[model samples]
Target: MLLKEVRDTLGTEVFSKEVERAIEKKVRLHFGGQEVYVKQSRPDPDERALAIRAEYNMTNRRELMERYGLGRSAFYKIIKGG
Candidate 1:
């Protein structure tokens, strides 16, 4: 998938410059069966959610929900501190 697609799919939650670079590096290493070489640790869910909220800048809510695999109620719960 294109970088834009990946970014959209990740919905700014877990999407960071470092994460993007890691993904690109992994993809490039895939042909050599060395994809695991670039493996990096992932942030926990709460941290990811916080990052998403911080990074969010008027992106459509519907699109964000869809991309992040969140239900309407779940998304609202996160935003509303419930």
Candidate 2:
């Protein structure tokens, strides 16, 4: 399906079935077995930083640590400037 769509978009005059198959093979070969990490949740670094900074106080340090699942060192680093 994808190959047919690509061939349609590129035009069969330039990319025939054989050419499309070869390109697909090369692409799979190049990208196959690669460890891919896709972020599951919304990752807003700036917003998170602001929230952390606003919420980082002396009293609720443990709460912040627990909410973010960070160790003391990592939480401190993140608040400081991660």
Candidate 3:
């Protein structure tokens, strides 16, 4: 499920506490010495656009739309605009 789905299901505060407990339990049992680095930055918009453009040019647009969960006309507009 998506993060939004999880938050909606469990509520934000409960979901966060559950996540913290899960991380602690998992790390304590399996990872004793390692450091976990979770960062705030993952997606880059410029890179994402380049990837979408590349896919639109090289792969099936239908598959791309499915992967993005975008409608045909909307996806086409985005591909053509970029």
Candidate 4:
């Protein structure tokens, strides 16, 4: 089942202590025949910027970094073909 389905059907409490701990550590979970890969809610800034740049001619690095919550060095690295 999708994560949302799992959450809706079982409620957030269905996440056991082990699952919660795994999520905290950003680890995948294998429970009851399901392999759950927990991920961040937001896309990585560099990834988002790359997509935006590809789709649109984004020229403002500062604006893009600020909008995506990226550090200056990381943003530059991503923009510079990292």
Candidate 5:
């Protein structure tokens, strides 16, 4: 999937759960060849820096712009580690 699609999907609460499911499925399929379902919970960052990184990871710059109503320059500033 494209980053844009992933970002849009992540906007929903179900996205987290779906990600968990995908991870569990892959682990089971490749490692043990077992069928198992896992519940995916939202990541809770312990530090502000970690949280900001996580937020960035969750969406691309374009998606972030649409979500936060920001411009490219601001997004670039943020992701630039400045």
Candidate 6:
């Protein structure tokens, strides 16, 4: 179920807790069925910036709408120094 669907169906108060569990379940389901293997992969400091932007672009519309209340969009727009 999509986050929006979950929120709409369950209401905000109940949905918050449910959503956390839902995400954990997804992560577990994805990994639990696979054979585990360790691999060394050093990350670059620049990667976090890339990841932040990638997440911002990919996050749900429901979250971005909430940003309007907190002026987060404006803050991001004027963000000069990371």
Who wins the lDDT comparison?
Answer: 2
- C-alpha lDDT values of all predictions: 0.73, 0.83, 0.72, 0.64, 0.60, 0.58
Per-model TM against the reference: 0.40, 0.45, 0.40, 0.38, 0.31, 0.24
Name the lDDT of candidate 2. 0.83
Ranking by lDDT: 2, 1, 3, 4, 5, 6
Clashing pairs in 1: none
lDDT of 3 at 45: 56
CA-RMSD of model 3: 11.3
Quote model 1's TM-score: 0.40
How many pairs of residues collide in each model?
0, 0, 0, 0, 0, 0
- What value does the lDDT take at residue 35 in candidate 1? 40
Name the weakest run of 10 consecutive residues (lDDT summed) in model 6.
73-82
| RMSD, candidate 2, Å | 9.3
What is the per-residue lDDT of model 3 for residues 1-82, given as tens digits with 9 covering 90 to 100?
3455766887877778668567667767896888867687655756765677787765588888887666878776777775
User: Which tens-of-lDDT digit does each residue in 30-80 have in candidate 2?
Assistant: 878887576789658678768888998878889988887768998787777
Q: Candidate 6 on 1-82: residue-level lDDT in tens? A: 4566867888888878667688768978888878778797765635633544454654553464364332556435433225
Decide which is better by lDDT, 4 or 5.
4
- Judged by whole-model lDDT over C-alpha atoms, candidate 6 comes out at 0.58
Off by over 4 Å in 3: 1-46
Q: Give candidate 4's root-mean-square deviation (CA, Å).
A: 9.7
**Residue pairs that clash (backbone atoms under 3 angstroms), model 6:** none
